[model samples]
Target chain A: MRAPALIVENLRLKLCADRGDTTLLSDVSFEIQSGEIFGLVGESGSGKTLTALAIMRLLPPTIKATGKVIFDGVDLLALPEYQMRSLRGNRIGMVFQEPVAALNPTFTIGTQLICAVRAHHKLSGHKARERAIELLDMVGIPEPRSRLGFYPHQFSGGMCQRVMIAMALAGDARLLLADEPTTSLDVTTQDEIVRLLERLSKDHGISVLFISHDLGLVARLCHRIAVAYAGELVEVGHTDALLQTPLHPYTRGLVRCVPDLTQIGVLRGGIPGTPPMPGHWPGGCRFQQRCPLAGNGCDDAQVTSSLADRTVRCWKSAASVDTASIENTTSPTNGPKNLARNTTS
Target chain B: MAAASVSSIWSVVLHRLMAVIPTVLFGTILIFGLVQIIPGGAAEEAAGPEASAEAIAVLREEMGLNRPLHVQYLSWLGNAIRGDLGRSLTDRRNIAKAITERLPLTIELTVIALILSLLIGIPLGVLSAINRHNRIDAAVTSVSGLGLALPEFWLAMLAVNLFALKLGWFPATGVPSVELGWHEHIQSLVLPSLTLASGAAAAITRFTRSGMLEALSSSYIRTAWALGLSPAQIFFRFALKNALIPLVTVIGIITSSLFGGAVLVESVFVIPGLGTMLVTAVLQKDYPTVQSVALVLTVVFVMISLVVDIGCAVLDPRTRR
Candidate 1:
């Protein structure tokens, strides 16, 4: 009976840059259920950050967006910016990757955290300050009351991220948009932050639209994951199903690129050519030029067909030949330990 | 670490103030030596043309111009230390008395010019930085460009023509007498102050625009926008504070230059400020008046630099350590 926390349907964006008008997000559609973590996986220049910005309506002046970004049954695109301002950092929170930079350097953690709290709430300054301490404690920061006065420079990388998490939780937000929250931290710090974010999402019953380029980390944390290539969604399904049985060639290429410890002396295979330029992309299949097994009909009308529980966008993907060898050979290798190495690689 | 506590800041300020002693000594010597080397005798100017050569020689000895250069300098420096710059050679009026009388008027003009430049320059910068390529931004840049192109003297003439002779809104040239009301004094300063502020305001505008642009694009500003702070709060609280740090240095430089700039503007308006006094003294070879004005300007300029440095440390916590 309840609507999903966020549903983005046919959300497209184009950048009117100095070069020309180019599509940044082509018909990107997905939905995140409440209390679930959905992953958006992509390589750099794949429009992952752009899609996140589109959800929050934070795109730059050079970019334009159209279609529906429905949140809790309200079409966000239709809401005025005055209304949107209240919704942002209130019902929907955001945690950017560079935790130190994401906070104002001049402001103390307490001041910044309290500002986020009081932005939407009508609490007294004292009450807001108390709430800021509480939020810091909730994010596992030690001695919250004393540490509140410290600036961003005083906190370690991991502690800074914990502060960012506290900031995201300030308004009791229902949906959190995390844009590569761990990309700037080290492997150890990244692991701690990932666990903290996952735990907070569960404890708070908040849905997260997690965006990252690390397939290994996404597989470990997400319930459902979608793969984006060259500003286009190529595959979508359950994390286990999509990675284990990749229906699209681009998805298969990404899966195979994850280093497999079982196959020694093999340094991982990369997708042959670079992701296509925006305005210069050939018509038909956007991936056809990169797809090795491209046949005559591969250049024909590229369609997204639902295969059991997964969606694949390709003409030849419907009658996919044997790719069991890819699944069998490509792995997290030694499971979780090797997965961390794949991220660094 | 630039993180400064109260005691540390006081110590730093104290240290900077002590350095002013040597600077004053060196600057006074330089000014006195340069004035002495000029190709004319103060005795000729002090005495009338019809006076005998014997009268001029007596005047030179009485004025201490006939003494050895070092002996003259020592006596002058000793008298200067006692707050007595002696008497002007040409007018025989006490130089210190003349300075005190004109000091307030010059201070008032420079302060008004300073306030005008900051008011016009900073906001125009913020507007242009935010609007970027819009019509208002283009207009602001072009206006500042015009301010840069037209020297203060030329601008002063045009202002006198437009607002004084043509419109008769302000007095074209004059300072208010002491008995005049405050508004009369302010009204007289309008054209003169505008002329003095134009060039300095142009420099301030350029610095403010670039500083504001940099601050606006910084990560913290994006964070503020992402956090949904109102545009006003984001600008006044976050972006403006960071933008103003660099502007403090610009202000210090401008303020010092404005002090020097007041000289010409004073001459133009015939206000009898220290600038006019210095010009008259230099033309008539009155050593005491020129040397005293130069020393005072130097000391004041250095003091302003100190204040600006301390102001910056206060505004930005990172610089304090």
Candidate 2:
């Protein structure tokens, strides 16, 4: 896939302290093909956000990361801070979670966008401002010129998210990392943002690393899905294949938890037990404690293997499943019952 | 567009003016009432014990000291509106003339002190914030703590002992005369200004450090850093201005506190300013001189607060709405 646009090789991040360290992300690796939306789905504290932060080199002073983040043949981790800064908004951009609080309250939308444009390029203020207006218009903001003078507080949540998207596209960034971009918006706004992002990705051919806990939304927007469970990637595959036949038990549970509108009189479900904290990860498979199909062999670290464009990190996936029984029993209407039985047993 | 911005500025100014008027009026009334309640009278001070009883009565009548308190207060207010502050009891000079002569020196000293505070305080604050929990921050915090501990008068005395007595770098007392050039006058003003500034500078540094720390951790700052803005740009363009909103509030309070600080610093430095004049007026129970000076000071304090409110509105556009 033309060098996969961006690649991470065995990334490990540790939260450092004066006394000791705690591992946040371990042996995490992934690659993004050009013009593809890759979903990293996990709940909060599952190291999904940490992985994005490590890729962007935006980790706090206390975080120590070890990995090779190769983007467009350049090793991002090895680059000097100054050069990395120049590459950030120019080649790679980020849309953070909260649209309302993400923007600087003191600056107008135009001023901030202009600053973003001028940060990477040596453009005149007038030129940058013109580009800002154009970018705002491109993001579907109505009357961009008139709204240029309005502060972030004047904009609604959806409008602010659009402004954030405009800022991300200000310098024609090649890769966009949207970190839970729609988590703070209304359901309708969430749908609008996802649609807009999909259209932008297709039109510009920009690769996006879309991070969210909402598997359903990820299923719609992303071409590939990487389900993260307790800081470990348990499954990675095409969105359709992964949803149709989730090999990893964690991925199966996540898929089952998605509320199906077609199945009436069905209760929505959630993953049983919270993910383990950073310092207290279980040995071997990180999701073993919570996996319904966990066996004695599951305690041994199993190597990830790929078959027909799908990769699963599980010991039981190697053995064949009774496809008929698995399919017939695992109806959307019976998802909650299965989840409840699994948790009890 | 320019007209709109100007009107916005005016709107802020008007709002601030409205807030300050009552405070100023309240201060004036309190000061006037306090002077009236004090033992002895201006007439007694003007006419000595050796003077005839008839002469004392005449002086008291002329000054309206025998009138009811409310009547005296109203008469004084009416005269003040017309720019008549009556005559000083001791020197027989027009109270307004005396105040005007002293006002320049006090304002000059205050301005110098404020400049010193900003010059030293801001850098110290920035440095402390940048190196939070490190040796630099610790040192700055300790120095500021010490500055706060030492009273203005004691600092002035220490400066006099070190610079004037020990180093022989400056004169021990008195202000430079009008014959001296502005530069020479400024040199004479420096020591007193720095002494007066120490406490304010320390307070400002502490406030600024906390403010900058808070601003640096904000989401916008993180976004700015992620946008690949240079540390300099992030610090100055994003963090510093955001920090200044809180710092400016501290500065406003400190500037008003300067009047109280000036009472001691001005006396210790022995400069011919309002502090010295107020002291003399108080000792002689010179009601007109005391009331006029107090009224002027209250007006200045209110005016400063008004400017600060306007500055806040301009700095933070959300306040305008």
Candidate 3:
């Protein structure tokens, strides 16, 4: 079997402030296989985005990061600044959330795209221009050559996003990191972008580490999902298994919060409280305060367990309860009895 | 496309002219009113105190001060429209002729001062922004602050005392007249130009430093760096271009101030420029000469501001709308 494309091992990050140091990420680890889409789902400030920044070494100067981000057998965190810069647009690419603001407003779309292409490779001006037109065409831009001189402000939001995707693909990168790429778009544009990204990933065989708070969308795109809460990974498993039965309470609450269009009168309930602050995370399970299944042992300083292929950091998942009955309570209200029947089946 | 470009240029010029009309009118009215109100009219000075009242009356009639205020203004305005600026009371020569002879020297000095300011200020600003909060930034800030505080006349005196008298490298006074060779003429201007440029350099350096610091923190600069562009590319293509909008506005203001500062520097260096002419007119109360020169400076300032505005619109597309 081929080695995993990317491996993040025991990554930890601390932000140094005037008051004191606050831990942002704690011992997070995951792996992405070739051509696989790995989803990291968390609420805002749960260290999901920080993990991406750490992998890219794009964190602010004051933060202290310690970990091993090994990609194709090379440790990214250990490379010098110059070598890391060389590898940034060549080996790895990133897509930010705000498509409109991500591009330089002063430059033409062609110039912006050509800059990215020439940044990693040397080519004559004519060849680079031809390549830029080809990339824009590939991203479904109409009249690529005619539109070459148009500035970013002239393009609509959806078209700007297409231009951004073309820029990200300029250097033929192997690993793509997309941080909430569709979060700022409208629903129609969001669907269109998702379809485009899916096609690109399939056609190019690019491994993607997709970060988002929209678990429903991630469920459709990602092969494997890691649920993070309060800077710690609370659970990790196959997408289908985790969606069908989330062992961690935080994951279950998140799945329950997805709006159901079929049930119009009933409002979906969200997680009761916000994610814990950085330095003030509760002992034992960080979700104990919000977890509906909290018990005496939930407050124990150390808790860990495994259920088949899923790893969960909850004391309750290991309890002696009727799994079938509990699984039914967590299912979406639309298909109430299906959960009951799946456990027995 | 040609039509579009022509229309756009036309619209830009129209808009700039409209914006400056009020300023031009206000400046002209204030200068004319101030010169008229000053005691000891040009006629009184021309006809000495020893002259009889009848002789003074004859001098006033010839000078056109015997007419009503409105008539006097219209006559002067008509002469200005025809490119005739009347005659100077002291020298009995054409005011326009006197201005043409002196204006070039002042303009040359101002241009040299502007070049010096840009050359020294922009680099110091870039360095200060790059090394923010370091020893170099602190030193530059403090030295520029001191330069601003020192009076221009005092600074000129000190420069002459040090470079011209003590070192014997340059002449202490007496500007090289037009009879001198071009090279000697320029050399004579060096000390005076430096004296005026030092103050402008100080102001520009402070402005550039602050503008660059703001641009460095902008998101676009960060985006440029993330795209794997080198530091030099990021500095020139992203940060510096954005920083120029603010710097350009400061340059316009500095250009206007140069007219006023040129007066003192011109006197100290003894160059026969408009500054010396204005000083002489004020002492002798030669109303026509002072009013004409003041009107010309106001017009020049309005034109410069219009040029700066159009330049900004071209450089930044967002401003065009």
Candidate 4:
């Protein structure tokens, strides 16, 4: 085993306001190994984006973060904002979710790219321009030299996504945080972006912390996936193992919610009920309200439980999936589809 | 690409210039018609009531009052186009010459006021927006509110009383001639410009604050922040450019209004600019002087508006179309 690129140890964030201090991320913990594509998967308002923002130290002033965020053996949380700023865009880069608004509308693509590069490195103007062109080309843009003068709005949505990727990679960071990078894109662009990101990570040997609500995309791209629910990391395991036997009830719920490509004609059902609001979480397992296997035992507090090279945060995991096998196993098509998507991309 | 952009810019500039013509023409007719409707026509006002009917007839004939209003307008418009605004009825001085003499001082006052307003307004506005709901924001708001509430003439008089009469830091009234050198000229402009610019500055501060607030909250700004560019870079480079687009339009309106605003401000400060000249000519019912000054100011406003439109297009590429 190698040192992880990032280790988020019991990270927590609370929004401090005059009315009351609301804990947003309550004891979140995860790690991304060097060169690994780690998926931080969750639904909306589950504090997935907040965790990414906390790692970047880009959270709002009202939102206070605590606990360790060690990147490559260095404690990030302990760094002053000045030092943290140097790490940002230098050792760590981020691609925001909305491609269109991610760029300064008034500035040309080349200017922004060059700025992002030069902000970290002491490159001369000529060298910075060259770097910008190379970055753009790396992101699969055509005629990179000519496209330099074009503004953000001049580019199509897909093209803008490429430009944003170019900018994020401009600093040559070791870890990349992509916050739902493909959510705003069309399906074809989303597919292309997924492939691009995977290829880049492989080629550069850079770690990617991909935050997304789309399970299919996450399943396709990430080697290891962490399921988050209501500010809690409910499950973490290798992709195939987790899919074959989703240890946590929430993970099981997510696995079943994925439409079986084999049974397309059959109606698909979603996990009922929303994740509880951060502060208003249930007294026991956060997912118990929506877990089908809920029992008196489920009412007990759920904590991380290690079982066979996987971490599951559910009280009834052994009985639910370990013995009977995953409910999603009926689809022989499921495993291959995810594998195929990943390989092709 | 360079050639194409240059050509496109030409087209935009030409389009803006073409737009100026109708605006100036419409403005002239409106000003002329409004002045004619001021109870007594210029000819009658020039010829006192005690003057005999035959004397009044001759005065009216000399002033071309007997002609149809449209014909008179066309002739006056033609003279104006040819740079011959006839001569002032009261003093027989060339109306154009009188305007040209006062033009430089008025322009100087306006420019100073504009620069001062922008210098004070933009930073304060950006700061207020950045620190919204804080003490600095509250103070800025209150000061701007005070500026907006006070009348320009009252402000001018008050400024003179405080800064000039009491402090003895400036001349009490009237702008020095250009021959006095740039220093003296600038010195004379301070009080008048302050009085004229404060109201517009107050408004600009509000517009800038609101525009900056909107830009600062935009997703691009958030992206900039996330990219780890310092807060200053995100604000000055990213947000300020977007914020200035709308502020440019507001400034254009403000600049155009300053020409008309000079009338009261000049009177209060006793500056012998076009505004005060126009006031004196109006009181004496100098027909040519009044008509020509009004026409000149209208054209100036149209020209300024065109420039501002182009500036907006430059600042915000999306507005080019």
Q: What is the DockQ of each candidate?
A: 0.42, 0.61, 0.39, 0.62
Query: Which residues of candidate 4, in runs, are more than 4 Å off?
Result: A318-345, B130-133, B285-287
Model 1, A242: alpha-carbon shift in Å?
A: 2.5
Q: After TM-score superposition, what is the CA distance of residue A156 in candidate 2 from its true location, in Å? A: 1.3
Q: Which scores better on DockQ, 1 or 3? A: 1
Interface RMSDs of the predictions, in order, are 3.2, 1.7, 2.6, 1.4
Residue-wise C-alpha lDDT for candidate 3, range B1-321, written one tens digit per residue: 234434666678788899897888788678878888887777788887798889999988987788998888777777886889988877888999899898888888888888888888888878787778889999999888987899889999999999999998888776786587877887788898888888888988888888888877765555566567777777777688778888888898998888889999989988788898999887777778999899888888898899888877665555654
lDDT digits (tens) for residues A1-345 of candidate 2: 455978988888888997799998887888899899999998788889888888889998799888889998988989989889887877899889889888898788888888999988799988888888998888899899888888888899889989998888777688999999999999999999999899889999999999999999999999999988777787899999889977777787888789898998776556688889889988888887776666698878877867767777876664423232335433444444666775556
Q: How high is the lDDT of residue B69 in model 3?
A: 87
Query: Residues B1-321, candidate 4, lDDT per residue (tens digit)?
Result: 445555666778999988888888898788778767777666666677677778888988988889999998888888888999888777778888888999888888888889989998999899899899899999999999987888999988988999999998888898777677878778878998988889888999999999999998887887776667877888788899999999999999999878778889999888999999999988887766888888888888887888888887777766655
Of the two candidates 2 and 4, the one with more favorable TM-score, higher being better, is 2
Worst 10 residues of 2 chain A by lDDT: A320-329
The weakest ten consecutive residues by lDDT in model 4 chain B span B1-10
Model 4 per-residue lDDT at A282: 86
Each candidate structure's TM-score, on Cα atoms with residue i matched to residue i, is 0.88, 0.94, 0.90, 0.93
Candidate 1: segments with Cα more than 4 A from true spot:
A1-3, A17-20, A259-266, A321-345, B1-82, B177-179
Evaluated on CA atoms against the true complex, candidate 4 attains a DockQ of 0.62
Lowest-sum lDDT 10-residue window in model 1 chain A: A329-338
The candidate scoring highest on TM-score is: 2
Alpha-carbon runs more than 4 Å astray in model 3: A295-309, A318-345, B1-14, B17-22, B39-42, B66-68, B177-179
Model 2, range B274-321, lDDT digits (tens) per residue? 989998888777777888999989888888878788878777777774
Q: What tier of docking accuracy does candidate 4 attain?
A: medium
Candidate 3 chain B worst ten-residue window by lDDT: B1-10
